[model samples]
Target: MKIKKILVDSLQEAIDITKSTYGDKATIMSTKIVKAKKWLFFSTNKLEVTIGIADSEDFQKEFSKEKELYSEIENIKSTLKDVVEVVKSTKQEQKTPPPITQVQPQNNEDFSLRAMNLATKLINAGVDQDIARKILEDSCGFDITIGRLDLKYEDDYQSLIEGLSKNISLKAINFSKNILSILALVGPTGVGKTTTIAKLAYMYKSQGFRTGVITLDSYRTGAVQQLQSYVSLLEMPLRVADTPTRLRECVGELSSLDIIFIDTAGRSQYDSVRLKELKHYLENVPSLEIALTVSTTTDERIILDSARRFSELGISSIIFTKLDETLYPGCVLNACIKANLPVSFLTFGQKVPNDIELANYENLANILLRGLS
Candidate 1:
């Protein structure tokens, strides 16, 4: 083993010098670029070039005066050669040893590149790459292949959904064709229970389903008022229930209506006692279907936990909200898988009736595939 440092104006010049001096027998051990000049080290058959300061007379003067620097470099080369010789001799002495041919991960850039490619796979499989990467890195302490992303679709509209579906059996309350004249929305806080009810009301009224808006969210200031604002626009009747008994009475009175939209207050899954109380209130409302309202952008773990908690309250189906906030929409997939819940609808934006989608499979599949591409 030999170490030769060649100073040249360019990498090409350095390569030429290396080839001319040692032909194909030389290899570059290491190379660096500094300023305008090139510094190259050649070993067996590979050439490593470093560009050094070309225009700086000071660099040249320092190089010439620094005898200790040259000595240090030489010493390093000598030590490396000795080590190599010792390793070879030791290996030869061994009668039989397992061959070690490891694939070397070169640098940080190489690692990140591998991770990015893995990220692409997760995205392709319907997992959001950014979130997946963060989750993988955080939980596993290493980036892993995005594995087994499932797509979910709702079958309520008789429209084929093209994503993964979980078999978590929520007694789905089907209201697609106005079969039931009255319907109620219920769920924990900010689950878009209000907006989803509004969308349903608009759809029912547009189709001449004789829709009415009912609210059990009057306890929260402005909650009832918000429903009123929309009801006023549609010229629809609005009923407010401060207690479950009132909700039961309202349901019976509204039985004659073609379709009733019930909006409930949002609550957290962790608030088990309050949530149970809320559930108990709606328990006697026999004619209403309690659909679980979920947000698409929340953490996947939280979504699963929420669904598990809500499962006790008898969620018929899920209405996923805020689809526009997440980059990779795989959280929906995770939710469905964990809760064994079917999707009924997805809300992409805050737009009233316009932004809501009926969780159709084909359309979602195409969108998810396009994102992967």
Candidate 2:
């Protein structure tokens, strides 16, 4: 395998460069948008391409790819429009949800009836056609039938279930009483972990829960202070712990509180020692739920790796932030679902509380719709 570098201005040019270099052998190893210089970085076994308008000659003697880069800009614009159009078409098809009833097996009376019922419910729920077909197909072979009825649609059946089922899931969660459970926010730095925690604390507090904020983020200066500011703004108490023993003590002190949210200092998931240390502390807080916070704007591989690493910490759910910054949120959904973790909330804006939404089937569907659109 050889590594090459091609500097370009847009995603399309990056793709083109990859195709030009490796043809059918190329695979997208990773990608990221460098915010400071505003460039797209595409990495592969074959090459690492920096596509930007920035004047840096890692690519050329002038350190500038092109001062007259508008030509590339025009090419990018045209390509982006096409990409958007394709996504729009896909979303439209997803909306229609192709019919699967005609394909149902007719010979098995009992099985067919049950399958039809499931199919009908899925169709009504606005599940996409392909998902419904797979559900129907996969479930037909099961021996005991009634249990299958109650189980929520499996992944293969998801796209086929009726929209009503999703809405029901959403409504059920919305109307369900707020359980007094601890939310432990764990993830890397600058991923909006603090802001996301503030949102959840505010949400529960507004609903009249005796919510308390605890931070084991003593390593970062102003960490406790920042949380304290939000704590004051929310009119809640914020406790700081300098070590795992201290964090355990903090949890013990908050034993009387209805809900105790523990915010650990952000560290890369791959930072084994720190992650294990944090996990060690949480292990002492029996019955506490770890809510992994991930920035939606991150590369998909990073999200997957982070989730995998934190799984050792026993993450119960996911909370994604920076949703507003990403044009497509499919990656967030994909990461969570792949990790087999339920999404708890999505933070779209920088606002303290207003930007967060409790994740449910419908909320996810809606977000997916918006992204594909």
lDDT value for model 1: 0.63
Give each model a TM-score.
0.55, 0.55
Error of 1 at 35 (Å): 99
Q: What is candidate 1's CA lDDT for residue 368?
A: 43
- Which residue ranges in model 1 land beyond 4 Å of their true spot? 1-173, 176-182, 371-373
* Candidate 1 lDDT trough over 10 residues, lowest sum: 151-160
Clashes of each: 33, 15
